[model samples]
Target: MKNKIIAEKSGVIDVVIIGAGAAGLSAALFLVRARRSTIIFDAGSKRISSSKNIHELLGFENKSPEEFHNLGEKEIVKYGGDIRKEKVLKIEAISNNLFAVQSTNSFVTAKTVVIATGLIDVIPEIPGLKEGWGKDIHVCPCFTGYELHNKKVVVFGLQDRIGQLSKFLTAWTNNVTVVTNQPFAPTWIKKLSAVDVQVINSEVASVIRSNGKLKGVITSDGQKISCDAIFVSTSMQASSNLASTLCKVDEFGFAETDAVGQTSRPGLWVIGNANDPIGHLAHAIASGTKVGPMVTDYLLEYSLADLIK
Candidate 1:
């Protein structure tokens, strides 16, 4: 496919970016503004899809996730960048500083590549819990806490980070409960009791449901506690199996990136939740913006050296 003389033969684009979430769109905007030819390929499975509103996003407060993405798409097109609703199945470095991106439709080649594909949350196995996902069950307060203000909240603890996450959730809701299946609470969770958040150290047997809505959670001892919503502090794995197939991932399932988001392999870069330890929308946008100029600079340097040769 790389041998085919089509878009690459006509010099359609200089860089190809994967994922059209905040990170990918932000990078496309920056590159297009800098007069660099850029194309963005997006899969429809954005993490923000389930979110109602985004908070602390600077001038986009209380705006729906669709609203933010629409504005971003408009900005990218306004700067002469192209956005295609396609999923990238594979990415390979065909030559020095040249990459081939394969999708379901066609294959395209570019001088540089940026992968902003984010992560996925693996919720614990509990009955009726999956039904309430994104509606009454949430993972990030920055995306769902506004609607939960002053409401009864239950949080499932999967790690030590729950203590810190509980404090953040309290800013939007007063009534909060932390439940762990373990017999004893973690030391950090014990310390968090000083903050007035109730901690339950019992196994969750099931999630009680009524009329397709979350009513409460049942413990192994047959104790049912009523609550309005449940939050799961589960594990987050990077959505970078494609990237990992081509490169290497760290111990925590994050792609190892250089200062400019370049991976260990040439002609490949990654940003956003795929590489970030703390995956926030603001941080994702920042990482993409930072990588844009670096990619353009790399292309320019290579072009200049080629002319001298």
Candidate 2:
């Protein structure tokens, strides 16, 4: 299918941004402020929506993930940037600094593209884990660990190296139990035990809930390990598959980008979790804010050259 080119009475759109999470919306805000035409495509289902409290976002530290996303949409629209809830199926480079982006219903030709699709978390296969995630089980200790401070916590991960990761939560709670499903745990067992951490040598079968709240985790052998919170050592992968099809990725599973979010491919840039798997909310906004001006300058030059012709 041919990619549809969106044009307005003034001229063609300056940039096309994928994903409306922090990065995408921040970029749009900057671009529109510069009077550059921009469009944002967001598939929704952003992982942050699962988070009850969006951590470390300055000023709105107490805002929920859903509320933050809504505010971002409003900010983008207020500045005259078009925000669409559509999934980008594919992006094709047509010519110099020009490409075609296709979605389920529509497509658009853009002078430049910014990818901020973020990441998808790989949750473990324990029964009830999916349902309890973000509420009882968490990947980031800082997100919910504070709430469970001084409470019983069970830390579970597939690797033995998770022993070290579990130790960090000691600041939040002293009652830390490291559950390594592997029969033979890692050599770091001595260091962990020295700190009074309990090492459980069993695989978790499911998350047990009592009256809609987290109770504990049940082991494969039917042992119930009581805990108030479960901290998961996330084995994260970037949401960079689409970007990888266009450019190379780093060893860390993130797309290689410059200091300002420009990718290896000209006219393409990556931001947020798609560029770095461990990027927090602040990093996403910073990267997008930096890239927005650069894209605006590039489009300005392109438009001036067009006028000369």
Candidate 3:
């Protein structure tokens, strides 16, 4: 079907979506299919781009993040959704519940705004850890643990979380070890012991890599522990501050939203990792799908009010 682009007298678009990740593209697909004039601002380099292959997401399993996003963008464009490769610098609430979206080189007005800006994983400052990120070093094993099944796995970082993560890794591998000097409560230690996970009380000074591959880790006490994969319970923060500017955000700058991605500010929505830091690819896709109808209904009511006026 040909796109029924909504043309407003004031040149306002039906929706302006920021961040062309899975959630943003998914939302744009729905809006364009619903005959809304949608524009997506894509600031390149999504959080998941670091992963060589995406897992757990059905159909796109083992596909590169770049490939998934490329296909998603194509589908949106096929539906007459305008996708721009520009970073949205700021968003202002203009009169009449419209929004002014400002990017690096373009500006536009929109009836509603959707922020799909994902979160950033704060990796521990261990030497060489960043070099092996998304490959040998990861924040969570839920998505990639199967690949490391029966292989030696190491867990570290965050005094409160390492114990639990170490224990969880046992489900995928019996050779689970946690490296941390920080003291854990007796219960946590007992839990790790019950799971047959090893605990090493030492600070990881650096990762041991050879020829661009992770070999193991070197502790501050000069202890070398070998592992096929390492999981760090790192902190996370929202990638963009735009949501914080327009809605109620937590300390990490994640927008506080309703179940359907509606922020405290009407006409503004936050989904994906911008709202739920721990949301995976599937969750992001589901979030975008859930918010599409809500946004469409909001536009319908808005158009009716304008007609009455």
- C-alpha TM-score for every candidate: 0.89, 0.89, 0.96
lDDT per model vs. reference: 0.79, 0.80, 0.89
> Judged by lDDT against the true structure, how good is candidate 3?
0.89
Q: lDDT: which candidate is best?
A: 3
lDDT score at residue 308, model 3, on the 0-100 scale: 95
Candidate 2 regions exceeding 4 Å error are 1-11, 181-187, 250-253, 301-309
Q: lDDT tens digits, residues 1-309, model 1?
A: 222223345564588888899899888888888777787888888876776667778888878889999989988887777778888898877766577788867688788888888888877888887777777888878777887898888887575667778777888988888777554356666656766788777767788888887889998888788999888887888875778866788765778888768888766789987788566789889998899888888878867888988
Q: Candidate 3's residue-wise lDDT over 211-299, tens digit each?
A: 98889989999999998888999998999999877889999998888998999998999998889887899999999999899999999
Tens digit of per-residue lDDT, candidate 2, span 130-208 = 8877877888776666787889988888574467767778878889988776653455766677767888888788899
How many clashing pairs in candidate 2? 0
The per-residue C-alpha lDDT of model 3 at residue 3 equals 52
Better of 1 and 3 by lDDT: 3
Better of 1 and 3 by TM-score: 3
Give the Å error, residue 61, model 3.
1.4
Q: State how far residue 245 of model 3 sits from its true place (Å).
A: 1.3
